[model samples]
Target chain A: MDTLRLASHGLSKHDQEILSKQLKMLRGRTACEWVLVDDYRSADVTLVQGQPPSDMPGIIALASTKAGKSGRYHLIEWPIRLFGLIDLLMAIELEWPARAATPLPTLSLAHRLARIRQDQWLDVAGMVAQAFQAKDEFRTTVSSFDELIERLASIDGASVRFVEGHHPLADQEAALEPYSLKAVIWSLALREEAIKSRQWHISQQQFGIATWPLFGTWETAPWMLRLAALYGRQPATLADGVELTGLRVELVAAFLHACELCELGLTVKQSTRPPRIESKLPAPESLLARLRRKLGLGYKRT
Target chain B: MISKILFIGPMGAGKTTAITAVSDSEPITTEADNLDRAQSDKATTTVALDYGEIYLDEDSSVLLYGMPGQDRFDFMWPILAEGALGAVLLLDHSHPDAVAQLDHFLEAFAALVSCGALVVGVGRVQNSQDIGVYQAHLKAKGLALPVYATDVRHKQNVLLLIETLIANAELNEILER
Candidate 1:
């Protein structure tokens, strides 16, 4: 960032001379040394005219008629502006390992688990961390799963998101409890204690889970497995699931929220199929049941 | 009448022990002196398959087949798993490439995976968090299969894996209906 070295290729000698003179005019204006180097190989920035070199070098300022940012290179255009070149060089300064300013806009995390990337860190204790002065242990009737999204939503939430590398909470990483966005969403969705969420609920539309929710990962009721199996098989509504599992409709609704929140992709059913259709085929003896009975195996919630 | 269930995993992941745990009789194994000692330090390894059985009734029986633990025997996986009720994939968590072994087995037994009839049991794991890693791996591969941390020597632990398989099978049956 100290020396703004510039090198040109395929450009007229007249343009190179003019560019050097223009850089010298802004000597005191910029803190760095704006030197127009003769060597294209060693230059910090390269200005190319017509065709750029095959070998991809450092920051490229393509002198083209095209406006705005191209794929990788910056457009210097027919007549390069000194400020544009300076701004491009300053951007290079911002990219150095020591500097810290790739600001991410803070947004409230509610039922928005899909938006959270795998790399982003979440501080479960948003505003509550300061108000209650609790470290990270918070619980509810639903899930003792850090009380992240639900608690955040209930308290009108304090925004939380740390970038993968440009971490805002890089210093306090170990101090804060970093929960996987999916795991947090799954726990919040599986509010096992209450049949229904206090604040909001997923829509009443009939849907089927695209995949099962790795139920064994959490210490939850065995009923969760039954619920997961049912919905995961085919599209069904809360009402459809109610009679099947003999669980409350609200509880099933809560499960739906868990599915949707975790970005499990619950495929909404089409009109061609009835919501609850009875199989016309005769029921056969379930081999699985016979095998279970043969092995004297009964599922106990482990 | 004979029905089939499978025990599958990488070499030395306790597929034989898991079968013997839940089997009515001692499982018959096709083993030889271990040549791949680098993979696992064991006197013998099942090169072909392991066989055991449980009587469903006085007349009928349930056959338990443990697929060979080597990748070379993957050809027999589809052949044996063709009509399998479901499968229990046992993994040795102590193995550095255990997760990779999981991906390998799950891919080899892609039929059971797609039908949601596969249960994963990771041996030598500590807690739910360790199980979470396996679950997360499955999650990444677009699978929601049941995963447990259990000692295969324990019959109850082995049964639990089978029970989940049965449950998944029954659930698939219900959905088909």
Candidate 2:
């Protein structure tokens, strides 16, 4: 069992004594044992009766009468009770992502890249081999970018994640057959199915083109241009884009999610609920539809 | 409405070929003997403008224009770019001053660039991926235009560049309003 030591600040002389006694009583019963300590620097959690020190690092429990306005610190109503303390500790353990006690032998592609850049871990062969075998969004090996794009076009994009830092599926030899982050994500979005995001909740957030998608060597269509045009006006939800463009909701969702993932810093997150999806677009004098017919954009002419 | 798109870059950046690749018919070009071997070894280069047209209908067409590679004929740029959709700036990666040329052509076409109507296409040099290098340069200059590694001779890449320019043109319409 892990031992979690806690330190207290602004505790009454009698309250500290009671906490010490409570710690002794609750030591062996819980999954994680708790002990009261003097120094916060040496403790897992620190309970402060008043305002917790600003920008404090470790887990902090604010024992205050008022509810927490900033959801940074754990809240414990004063005077703190045994149940509050127990609940706070339990919640902290639950909230933090559970990393196994032992690290995995085969590190992820992201981890390997990080290790190579940070620690200069010289495992290029291993990195290449691991990435080639990657069944997820981390799949890196391709003869040409066009080939990879063709593959992405045929596969299911719903499971692919537009994770930051892992945007470019780069190896040492990626320079020869390189792909832009935009191209990779855009091709994945071609699957035109409901997709996952490493960052945003696709249904819950509004998306806009904060910046243009940096598609290199990847052919774009008129509807995509229209999509960019719509986003250029204002930030909109995926459903809004779908209705206006008459594009697949899944396609728009994945595309918007990819744009956001590229760190274009779109205007999103004002609302948590999904938008009202309506079937409406600009008046029949649509230049995009006309352009499509004249230029053979929607259909492959060549 | 006629939407004219220009392809501008330094000598031998494959502007003529790019225009030819996507043009519906054989493009018109005024090619003269290359007196500047130090710049480009190509036997002939565009002196005035290389013209190609995709006939949209009997009334209108999408005009593909290629600006003269040499800066001496730069007087024709603003004249050609007037009421133009945008321009694609192709770079010959082998040129020693390719990066400098990027800055130069970008500065030359600042109006088109500022309105998000420019896409930079850099041809690859051997096994090198210089897309990031060009992109980093664009980023440093606070330009958000797309930089692509392409062989403009390939119809796919040329078509994509045209698509990108169209996308930019559509985007500019919204942003301007």
Each model's TM-score, in the order given? 0.56, 0.60
Each candidate's root-mean-square deviation in Å?
A: 14.7, 12.3
Say which docking band candidate 1 falls in: acceptable
DockQ of each: 0.30, 0.17
i-RMS for every candidate = 4.8, 5.8
What is model 1's C-alpha RMSD?
14.7
lDDT (C-alpha) at residue A184 in model 2: 53
Question: Per-residue alpha-carbon lDDT of model 1 for A104-132, expressed as tens digits?
Answer: 22222534333332344444444312111
Q: What is the C-alpha lDDT profile of model 2 across A1-302, one tens digit per residue?
A: 56677898778888888778656644543456677889887877888877666755578888776333247687775755443454566556555444234222332222222112111211233223122212112234565667665655554322233333432334544433334434455555444333432234546666655455555433466666556545644566776676556766666765664454433334453456655445333223344334545555542211
Candidate 1 local lDDT, B41-152, one digit each (tens): 9889998789999876776787999888876777788899887888888889999999988888888888888888888888897644576688667767766667777788
Ten contiguous residues minimizing lDDT sum, candidate 2 chain B: B124-133
Q: Which candidate number would show the highest lDDT if scored against the true structure?
A: 1
- The candidate scoring highest on TM-score is 2
Deviation in Å, model 2, residue B1 alpha carbon:
3.7
